[model samples]
Target chain A: MLTLVSRNSPAAPSGNRRRRSIEGGWKQITINRAFLLPAVVVFVFLFIIPLAQGFYWSLTDFTGYNPEANFIGMANYAEILRDPSMLSALAFTVLFAVGTTVIVTCLAIPLAVQLNKVFLGRNFVRSLWFFPAVPSMAILGLVWSYILSPLPSGVLNTTLNNWFGIDAVSWLSDNSLARMSVILVGVWAQVGWHAVLYVAYLQAIPTEYYEVAKIDGASARQQFFSITLPLLTPAMVISSFLLLTGGLKVFELPYTLTNGGPGFATNTITQALITSGVSQGRYGLASALAVMFTIVVAIVGFSQLKVTTMISRRFS
Target chain B: MKSRALRVLALAAGASLTFAVAGCGSGGADDGTTTVSFLSWTGQEQMEPMIEAFQEANPDVRIEASYAPPVAEYIQTLQTRVLSGTAPDVFVVAAENKTNLIQSGAVVDLTGEPFMEGVQSFNLDTYGSDGAQYGLSLSSWAAGYAYNEDMLAEVGYDGIPETWDEFLTMLQKLKDAGHTPFLESVDQMPTTVSAMLGAQTAQMDPAMDELIFSGESTFAEQWTPILEDYNQLYTEDLVSSDVVALDGDQVRDEFANERVAVINAGPWIINAVEEANPDLNWSFAQVPGRDGGMPFQAGAAAPGYAISANADEETQAAAKTFLTWLASEDGVQMFHEATNDVTVTDNFQPEVNPVFEPLVEPIREGELYLPMISWQRDEDRLNIEVVAQIQRMIQGAVSPEQVASALDSQLSGS
Candidate 1:
């Protein structure tokens, strides 16, 4: 007592037991790390190695067919900066990503609330909403291209003419209209799936909280703002993140619908990548564009995650 | 126990490694027959019969054929295989990849191969460079105006006119008779513009593209007039600017449904349009020229077969035998029956549909032009720029001069 003997003193039996426990813990840690080896190998080979190779290719004039590519540092980046079509592609890509994310979130939340209510043919209606999400964006785009065709014989235009006697509107011909139509169709295609995600989260909220709020004379709107909205923040984070990333990577819809046309009004960065890298054989230049696009996507993604995480923390 | 577990894992890994090593064995058999790997541009349905015929005729040479559909998928697949040194012994060399294949020395030159003889020179030159042929092109296709006979009859014109002025007049009459006059999908290089450029270039000694590419001329100087003339369809309100948003299939549908009078079409559309409307009377006509130019058609030779440069001498010889058989009269006939393509080989005359008869002569004579096929370099890049700028021109966002100037800038890489 006077010496304040440590538990690990060599003279004590408990010290020996502690030593054995430490040795067993080390062995367990070794086994755990061994279990992680395959995953680490896969990550390095697939993601890290390809990323490094792509970065190396970005600095060269590597026409896809040629193996002996000459190092032409920054020429490809400089070319991308000067190209107007590429710039237009960047602008439209950003527009589509932000537009679809904002619009789908706004509509999907309200739609989920409505779909949560008991109604006639509720399953049928839910299925109808989810149907668009079932088909590929490419197929949906083709079908909608016919529906949104600017001609008088188009499905929507014909309906409008027959019902309202209105002239055919150029849904995909005019620049602004084409951009808007693509974004709207994108929203329509995704809103239902995102709503289903919200519905799952909505169902998890306990009924006790709402009952207590009702007993306190809390208005429906106030209770919703305080309870439903706060708890839905987690779903918002997931849904918005998906919408943003998917929209940023969009290629098939605008490609099949307008083919990035009416003069680059609907061109996407992904389309530009394919056109340059695969179609034109300018792999180096495409790599540079891809590098820039990746940085942009990362920045946007991280910013969104940070904002959503802060919201979640505050709400929780 | 742990060591026993490790032993099991080691045994499994050893088994996997052995199987993978065995999988990398050579493509050969105990028999003396040589196997030639081929990547066909034609679809499997159309290519299988021809491959079967070749293997039957050449008992000693076997074609191990695979297919990727044209034009983008085939190009990308071939490019990847060539780069990886796993390319087929034989493959297609299309306009899209001809320059790359030649520059990288991935294709064998067939300049004076016996298989190259009797093929159309224009078709050969399409996939050649500096007097060396690299592809065995067997057929050609041309796109021209397919007009509705009944609609034209209603407008008091039996055929598309021979000049731009008359064509416009006919279009106006069709419009006044309550019909959509003309629709050429500007989604690509418009057939009208290509045919017009073909007419103008057909008269030049140095050739228009040669002059422009060699830096003796510029797109602004050679293309502005043609652009202005072609823009009249929109500016004069004979054709809708909305055609910028239309694809070939849409325009063809409009023609098939009897809503539009004329649409740019090739032999590929013959069956679909006929099936869509059996009662619709239609015939093809050359795209009219402008300002004292000959009537011309926008077309290119179909993608051609080429031997891979990386293949061994025996494999290459087998590849050549396959191509030679493909170019033979019987082979061409079999191919024509399978695909219904307009065959351009000297020995066999393809029997095309009656509605596609008018454009067949031009195809056979190789009197057709496609700018992408003829461009010396930067063909895809220039094609993209031109199509976009022309769309802008149709939208009235840019003038004809601006469209031509954009091409000039793109070519100069400014």
Candidate 2:
């Protein structure tokens, strides 16, 4: 509509003048587009080329050792589809991605709101919450494994037994509990960072809006719902996107904690990819899995963006 | 601005010249010494002394060593190098990569090398195909039950039993005495199952893996009974099923702290266990056998040094010289003192810890078997299936027969 208005304006330039203006605009545009060359090069080299190579390898039996692999065509994909463990891995990967995203978002916002208040030692509290994000997930997983071990001597189990006479729980041995433990540990590791993101967004919200709400006799809860929640949609979009993608790509936490057992209960696609490609030397099959996983991630990521955009529009 | 540009170019030229000179210095100094690049599987602290000893003995060969930690990282690094045509002059050929290395002709055959003479045939055969030995393996390792002597004595046993039935009875006795009988990490293949399978194979005319891989037998036919026997540890409620969640370190800690009576372990745990509890009375015993088979261990030759086929003849010869010294008595002694591994070369007797002495003979005599090392092909894939399925069996989600049949299905890719 704006383009149409500009085009139909009554005081438009003459034809020769417009020609000269467009020529000038073309040179300006060329210079501007030249600034994008480095980024384009990086994207091509880092993402697109590797993606294309992976797709090509997906159609062959390129074990990591030899370059002269035979073209096998769809066999790797078919094998993935047929394998029960691979299917289970897919199920758990989706569950983890969706589970952590929802739980973390639900928990992080309230935590962020509480942390945003002018409480005593606010900086210390924020730092305390953010400490879990400092260490690698692999380290956290190792520590949590010992804490949540199923033995009577485990840290959590021993505490429970001492304090409440509770029995040992199979934290990592049972399928459902193992999945839940991994997701919870993931949430523990990431919730602080996401909350910090929310706190940043919360700080950006104009203070005058809340003052005006107070003058209108709005209560704290009413003011929050009307003023704060609507404006935080953009933050939600970014945080949830990050959470979903990180959760999907999770490998180390589950790997160090459960080693994807007691029957692949916490297996992730990335674990399968590494195990097959690097450890088993079945790079072709791993490439096929990677390609499929990429498609899945793209679909989920875009669908999330669409939903978040719709929510943002509704709130706006 | 022109002067600044000239200064930057001059600095860059100086840096390039320095790097070129340093690169030249890394190799032999053109003094008839040949530099052999080695990608070591051992950590730097352990491998450095062995390299120094070898270089001191053979001054003509300068060892340029780089280290990658074992198993996955080392394999991936070496694989990338081999494919990119930048592999070291010598690298460790492990069970994980032996088949691929041999099939791709990435390693030179060391069958007739004098250094290969005193090494055990089992070590040679592990990295060989069709009688062409490729790796000089100087050491072997075995895993068995590392039992706490005090706890076993409390249960009226001085050592681990030699038969499965007696072992189960002892476990029951220990449990009755309010003690944890055994703990074996099922994160990898269970040591108990591997030992039982080894015992079974030792008595078979053709090795069990040979029959199964040759298609004359199936996992269901040969492995179901053993799987059932192993499952007894969990099913009879003697040992906890939570072991599926435990790793070797956790189990070792339990034994070290005297919280568990016995745990399946290898020599690698010796230092940690001793350090954790210096006065802990412990000894290693072969895993008990079943149905009158002899006791055996789950073990294999340690990763061996293989000269790269891609190296030039001179560097390859230098690599060979390194391996020859590595297999010598003095070199083996230094390696043993550094790494605490039982060297299997006949020229040197590795003085093992007294607690670990019982399993050392079997390691030296090559009476060890690990399914991943013995499988003809698809080792990693089959290993993953076995572990997961066995965990499922322990959890009561699958039967022993189903677990064995799952391997058959995995092997057939069905």
Candidate 3:
């Protein structure tokens, strides 16, 4: 850390009393060198190293289990293009990612707006919403499985039968329904987190904009569209990007909920990767899959950032 | 240009190699004692007594234990450790990681260990490949219906049926008298496949599995009749597909609550029932087989110990000594008394749950199996696919034939 920090700091005005080189000395160099070196080392080590490794592995047969690997060229990339399970996982994953991101963003904005306003039991409600994220998803999944099981004896079905005379609902067993149920649970788990993010950013947007709009006879909805949405763009970008990446990498919730069952209805790419790679001892194939997955994720993530930034620019 | 570049390149390569070597040199030989780090796949309760006994017997050797909650977490934790080159000296090589553990050379072969003397042949074969033992298995666990005698008497049956047909007829009688006939945990592997195959494997020759996988026969050819026989529970509307959702603990609770007449279970579950409802009129029976077949069980040797491939000669010798002691008469008895498992050694036997007496002979005589542990390769994948297919079959999606064909395709592809 010390070595990294001292190599790229900004020049200090009069620290260099000694001059080894006549033109410019180590003192001036060290002053500027100190600050930038830390960032450079961190940036290189944490991001660049892993990214480079992933890219290199994508071009080879690096099964995660084995030490020795061979260059397989683009066979991994070509295989991913044809694999059906990977494609299905991708489709459902995108549906889940996009659906949760949009729904959570819309719901959270209003939720944050309302939450910020003083209410009789605002703190209590805040805790209730945020508590979904507290319990491990695995436990919550088991609880929800009992609640949504497709049999008459299931908890939800029994309640519905006595109260409303409705039959059982198979939330996870059916294909389309399982896809939708996963997205709903994803939204339920994350809305509070994104809402809190919005709440933080909401405090920063000047209250004067709303007050000035009211004086100009602008309606509440108009004021929100013109003033609030523009200022909230950066937060929106940050939250949705988080949702995108996190959603793509999710393994536990779907795994616990359905174990990628009803014939791969709720399977995720990560689950497939772990299943095929670690469990099946196809490490080289799994590594190839992982490297390719990392690339696709990076590509999608950066493009989304660019699109969001452009949209933010338009709104502002 | 070449001379100037060469000078800088040489310095850079030297510096990088120095850094790499420094990281590699961090691990070296320990002091006198060999520190064996093990991952206990079983939870603390089941493992504590055996571990304590092992520790008491070998005070010089120290064993550090970590745990993952169950199957999934155990596999993941081990994978992470093995990948990072930090796996335990002695850990479980259960059915879950049998293939990968052997395939990648993650576990050491126990072909000539002294501890294996007089150990059950079933235990050896369960963890072995090509007739070479890799694990020193301690006990076998069989799962079947834990029947309530009162309920069967309510439906007018003195004991478990001998044939698959009669078992269904008994379940029919129970349902006719307003009893929930059964509950099985599809979330965990059910004993249905075990009972169906376990018996056949015991009677058949060793060359059979190789022939079956070589496309000489099919699972449908053998198992369709069993599934059709078992499907009577669902076809007759005696049990529900609700089981596809519930796990062992929930099903156990149902049995505890006395709402259900039967539950698919193992000896591991005896304590839960004893604690929950002591007065319940329950006893286990082997699953009824096709054409009055020999009663078979879905069971295997519990996780066995393995020496680390990375250990030095002295540590390896010390580990071998520990393993030999563990299999000794005193050690086996201590382990069995603590675990209450039906150990297969002829040297010692611990008094276990009273209901287990009927099963002790078969377990010790090596007449049980676990399907995942019995496969030649891709055991985990095949098990997962089979369970999912069974779930689908119950849900009315695929037939028994399709399930078998799917497995054959998977086998062919790999």
Candidate 4:
């Protein structure tokens, strides 16, 4: 997907070859640079400007309506540190991110490997697994709320009652259960998409290496651990990085499912940020929360990437 | 390779050029007619007819109407526009954004405006500060307990009792009769609690908020009894603790199916209840009172229409004409018929739905009580915390005193 060879093509020359090649290389670099100006302009206007404005707002008592705001120093940040709800949200956010990353990765890799094997209706099974990722998270959340409703008349509850005589379970009521329900739904929605990514990488691995391993009397498990696992490191690096970042910034699944309810059991940082910044008029404080949230997510996400990259490098 | 690179650069430049061209707004018409831009908080189904009526009445003013659904999306959309000085000439002033709009001087004061004549004082005062009105509110909504008549009859209770103790007895009787008595969605402030607080505040000289906000009293002292009374439903097992997970819609469905005898609801659910089961017999009642105090309904003044302060004189005049027509007798009647909202204007006595007749008196007299609407400051933040803490109380994790104290802390912090 990424092409570097044509850009790095050496200039063909005979006399005064070194100077000609240097000039040609410089020209190619200039052409490549010309193609990047649009992206640079977009990044500056869209990302950097708003980010700078947020940082500025974070340092003031800007109530979001008034253009004229007082410079309140670090008062908003200090308030955030002392607010128990923000701290609770922070805890849940970390738990959700770590839980979803671990669960989705553990499930997706195995499912991807199984889907890659020759089996009856394998393509159908792959499509079925990938269907959950097709619809928007908000819709899935609404449907799952009905399925996991605490009422006896709820879909899943009725089924369990009829088939097994089980009483209705309070899936989204108890605090810990609500958190687990949100995470479980989140993992269910995401694992299949990551599995699809792994499948693409699986197809790219050469069959000759597996054939050689098989001829050497390597069992199927050995083939997976030795040959297949190492080769899938690149995909693992990409998948886990996406998972870590996406999991940290999640808002919709929990928002539509439980709405950060049962006493803030499923509340995440983004939900708290949006509530403060937009729903509530505390834009200055919301901006401060946003600034701190971005930094923490960056730290967690980058550290995760570095560690995963190192582990994948060992496998490579 | 060079040609391919040039093509890629050309594509990027072309895309940016297109975006720049599209970003510029369309200019006003050359026609003499004044076009007043409006942002509606109501859904299009209800707003379109009203806009049509306004346009028909005043041909000089052409309303360009747009809508963002309440509460979050509308707030965010209007907030950005107001902040950027591109707000519509007319928009709905909702509880979520009213504080910002009023404080930012984004909306014009309409206290003594000619258009505000015959409008309900309570509606105007809800959106106003210190006797200066900013929004022309036309209607108010009341939420109380919707009871199944059959269920009440089965329990030998003709109606919801007046006293809290009697109400508890009726709930116990319903439970003994093998019917789920009550289910209130804990996603927001429970209606029963809001009504009791309203009854108490109605009796106060300076209002409950005035006493609390001015530091003469605290929520812990004012709201503890109400919270304790509300929590009794959960404590005594008259209501399910699983209600912490149920929303208004789910509870409404349970009521519709007769699975629950009563559900805390508002006029918003009437259509849904009827559509789900037209054969079901249901009626609304003021939430029962504590001790001998008169029963009260939990409600608020509906969101009102406000003109932008930034609009030019001619546009503002045109917008005023629209607002005037919207608050007139015909406009209020049309609004009530279209949306089933109880009209609050003095000039218009609306015909409410038969099922919601019990709510008509309170809506007309402006006896609604919504804490977020009446609170002097930090309404949304306090509401989020209050709802969460109340849910915790419902789940037996926190006491009623703790719920009230949480509000006190939230008020102090804000």
Candidate 5:
């Protein structure tokens, strides 16, 4: 409606009158504003409103089942900080985020580089690599649970035992191994998808740069280091940012795989949040944990984004 | 043409928004008859017939029903609906959410209701708080170790032993007979451990959690021995430590395949076990006693039917009718026939499978326990923590004492 009004206000035909030019600019502004209206409405209603409600609930004693609850100041937040389980969850969440980010980035870039090359049955290989990400994480977690089951009946354990005469390894029972198994499955599920993203970015880079490097007596390794690696930095920036945030909020994989057990070895903050808020009816404390989690994630995500962007710019 | 297309798009969008708004509204009709909306945690196949039966019996009350799958999903759906003031007139109050439901006054108090008469007091009190009943629980479930008859006979035992030592001896004999002795899923609380603790706590002056929360006793003191006794399977190398990574389904499968002679299971597994190996003879028994304590089973009242306190008088009345009918012998018999749950109403005795005959008396008499159902407060949080710590204990990362103290810390922190 505003776009139509602004369009009609500019009445001068073809002539560059100042009033007409001003109205034309107004017409452009109105169109842009009109285009953004739906998104802004969605953002305010879906994101901003819920966030404000969460912030309010964090300061209240809302038990999730009740609509009427008293404001309790910062007791929930204070309690969360003092809680040991939350601290353990926080530690593992950070470790998972950082570990998955570093490891997946290292693996994805190389995988993408290889996937970019022409080979026999290249499409099949690419599809095979990408298939893990196609299924939901919950399904993958269940599948991996069976594959990595500590029993000799598990697929991998049975293979190891029958083929090599090895004892069954307690893949998800030990604390360190549980954490590592979760991260390993996480890395496996993610590396292909991120590599696919890198593959898209790799396609965008001009062939001339690599061609020039090749012509200048550059080895395959040197060409990759000088050109391909530099060009893939933007993908790295986006990929790492996503991995960091998603890893921080991860619940299902760890939940289905080990249920944050063998104790709270692989428990993430979001799992804590869900268990407290949804399952345990401690919505107030969960909201507080959520608020703290959001702040931590935002700080880490934004800082990592800034660092990666700077690095990418330097490389460019 | 472009302008026409834009107009068409706008019309479609407006129509969709209208449909979306209309779709989100409550489905219960109000056409002179009372329409009581019900949300069931049980699946539609189990609940639909009951709704049909209720609607047939009470023509003035129209029954509208929906379902959310059990446990976490059901609790979350009910919670969201209750907080939004859109909860159904009737819903299931599960162990995990009964505390919240009662404390928030979200459920109707069924105290002194005629429908509650003859209903098992244990089932009623499971969802009750402060001497007021909120949920009309109809049936209860008990889980214990189901053993293969042939396997036990091969080891020269006709039935499971009453004491822990004799049971371990039987397990060792089975192992020595070239058979896999036992398997219990440690995904949640171990059945053997919970049952042992249940037997002990049932005999205590005050209930276990009551004494612990009152500061008269500590979990570290009370639970350490139970933990040690339960952990002896692993310590004595009678059961494989790999059971830590197993779940109920896997254990059930192992039993079905005849790879294992015993497994922790409940009536829920009866059909599957029968279907898997009909020729194989199996029977259920309570977990063995320790230190002369009576054998007990890890069990609880089934999640119950509770009316919403916020419902209109008409809907509430209709919901009461539904609950009364549910507690009635006919309703109990139908429910039992459908779900095979041990109905606990005094007037009704659900016919049991011969295999489950051992548990029939206990279920009827309400001699079952689950820590989640019995705990006075912080039940869900404590259960999660305790389960995780127990898993840790099974993995040898933490001692039984540390695991018990973790509960202490969790309770104090909460």
Candidate 6:
């Protein structure tokens, strides 16, 4: 309504005139600003403001409950760094972030390529792959908990025991195995959704490029490397950033799977922040951890954003 | 055209955001009849009948309830809701939130509310502070080792030992017979400390809590011996530190399905055990402690209804009416029948699952005291520390005394 009203009046024409005047020297700024206004609004309101609030809280010892909190400077950061559990959770979180990003990217591309082809029950296959991401993590966790139970009576273990004549494996008990199992489950839950994402982007690539390469007597592999790979770089940048942040901020799956232990083996930074801040009533400490975590996350996120843009620009 | 394509992409992303936010902001309440979102930690199947009873009783109060499993998830979900001001009018505030729930003004403080009439003091005190009750606790639970009777016979022990020393000796005998003696999940803090503390409370002129909180003695002074005594199983190689890596559910699963003689468990898991291994020989017993000490339990009061302080007098009264009915004979029976809890009210003697009978008395009689439950300070913080320190203790990374001392330091730190 406001936009319509403004457009209908003569006053906005002068505003547009001012814009045109500035467009000579600041033309790119006007263009970029116009193009990005809607997205900027969304990113600022939903993401930026909340992140700023979170960062501010991190600086203060903002116990989640108290209406009043005091600024404790870098005390929270100092404590979190010194604390062993948070460090362990951070280490595991990084491993998980890197592991899933590398593994899922490799898996999803191939999986998307296969699904994009005409095959028997192709739709059915696609749905089956996508099914894990459909359910809430809580439900999936309950189901997977039983399946990954360390006992011989556990679903997978019992099946493996009978079918393969093997002993029961403690999928969630041993520290390293628990970490691996959590990562494996994470990949299982997410890879399909990501594959579907790649599928959507994959369909967007022009067939003319592939055809042109074929017309040049290029083999399928040659065409993929010369044409398809370069085009997919933009999508890769987007997908990898999502995966990195998603994996870093992962809480539900690991919490559901292991509750951050055998002994803090599979804990994540967010989980530690939450468990300490909310459950323990150390909101101030928690907010501090959160604030610091946000800074770290922002640093990582911005660096990845820069790297992805560069890669995409190189491809362009 | 490029901008149009970007717009299409943006719209798609926005649509997915709608989907994502929709999933969380609303938790799948489809029947959609003025849904009163009830957040429970109870299992889904267990809540069905109780919900049915509520619907039957108050047809106007169209209820929509969902449960996060238990402990951490339940706490996390409630925290999110409360912090975001999206919490249900009614929600479970177990021991983990007993302090913060009250201090944060998240729960209703029913100091002299009408719904509290005829409610037992033990249940009230479970979720209460000095004089004000925050929750209308409906049930109480006491967990101990669920033992195999036949295994006791094989080890030449007729039943669970009455004394802590006797228990250790019995464990040694079981080890001698080449069986895994006993397994308690150290992924949680030691239940025996709570049971022993409860025992001490029963004998105390004032209480263990009073003395400990008054600084008469520290946790290290009180619990070090108990932890060391408990560690006899590890030191003697009757059981490995493997148990420390396991939680209550895993322990219960092992006891139900494995050849292990005993598993640390509570009444909540009886149904799963019955369904899985109905023929398994099992019965509950109080965890043994120093012989002269009172046979105390390691249980907590069940989550109950709390009147929202923000609600108007009319809504508060209406909510009170509902809660009062829940504590009444019919309501108690209905809820107990559904949840299979050890409901502690003189008004109702619920026909619980037979396996839970052994725990019923201890739970009802108010014969339990866990240190975390009794902590004058932050319960969740101390509990997490204890659980971690205990895990390290069992892993041979730290000594039992060190674990006790760590608790003391953690308690004193903040």
- lDDT (tens digit, per residue) of candidate 6 on A116-201: 89989999999999999999776777678789877666789899988999887868777888899888888898899988988888
User: What is the per-residue lDDT of model 1 for residues A1-316, given as tens digits with 9 covering 90 to 100?
Assistant: 1111124545655877989887879979899899999999999999889888888899998889989899999999999999999999999999999999999999999899999889999888888898889999999899999999999999999999999999999999999999999999999999999999999999998877788788878898988888888889989999999999999999999998899989999999999999998889999999999999999999999999999999987886
lDDT comparing candidate 6 with the true structure = 0.76
Give the range of the ten consecutive residues with the poorest summed lDDT in model 4 chain A.
A1-10
Give the runs in model 4 whose Cα sits over 4 Å from its true position.
A1-20, B1-31
Mark the 10 consecutive residues where model 6 chain A has the least summed lDDT: A1-10
Give per-residue CA lDDT, model 4, range A8-114, as digits (tens): 66776777787878777997989989999999999999999999999999999887777898899999999999988898888889898889888998899889999
- What would the TM-score be for candidate 5 when compared with the true structure? 0.91
Q: Mind giving the per-residue lDDT tens digits that candidate 5 earns over A19-55?
A: 6777769978888799999999999999999999999
Task: List model 5's recovered fraction of native interface contacts, to 2 decimals.
Answer: 0.84
Candidate 2's DockQ: 0.75
Give the TM-score (0 to 1) of chain B in model 4: 0.92
lDDT of each: 0.91, 0.91, 0.76, 0.88, 0.87, 0.76
Q: Let me know the TM-score candidate 4 reaches against the reference structure.
A: 0.93
Candidate 1: residue B213 Cα off by (Å): 0.7
Candidate 5: list runs displaced more than 4 Å.
Answer: A1-27, B1-31
Candidates ranked, most accurate by DockQ first: 2, 1, 4, 5, 3, 6
Q: Locate the minimum summed-lDDT window of 10 residues in model 2 chain B.
A: B21-30
For each candidate, give the TM-score of chain B: 0.94, 0.94, 0.87, 0.92, 0.93, 0.84
lDDT of 2 by residue, A102-144 (tens): 9999999889999999988999999999999999999999999
iRMS, model 6 (angstroms):
3.2
For model 3, residues A1-316, the per-residue Cα lDDT tens digits are 0010123677765635433363466677788779899999999999889767767766766545456678878777676666656677777677777788889998999898888788899989888888898888788777877777765666877899999999877766677777777788889898998888898888887777777778878998987787777778989999999999988888888888877766666778898888877676665566667776777788879988999989976775
Candidate 5's residue-wise lDDT over B236-263, tens digit each?
A: 9999877767788878978887888889
Better of 3 and 4 by lDDT: 4
Best candidate according to DockQ? 2
Candidate 2 lDDT at B51 equals 86
Ranking by TM-score: 2, 1, 4, 5, 3, 6
Q: Could you estimate the TM-score for every candidate?
A: 0.94, 0.95, 0.85, 0.93, 0.91, 0.77
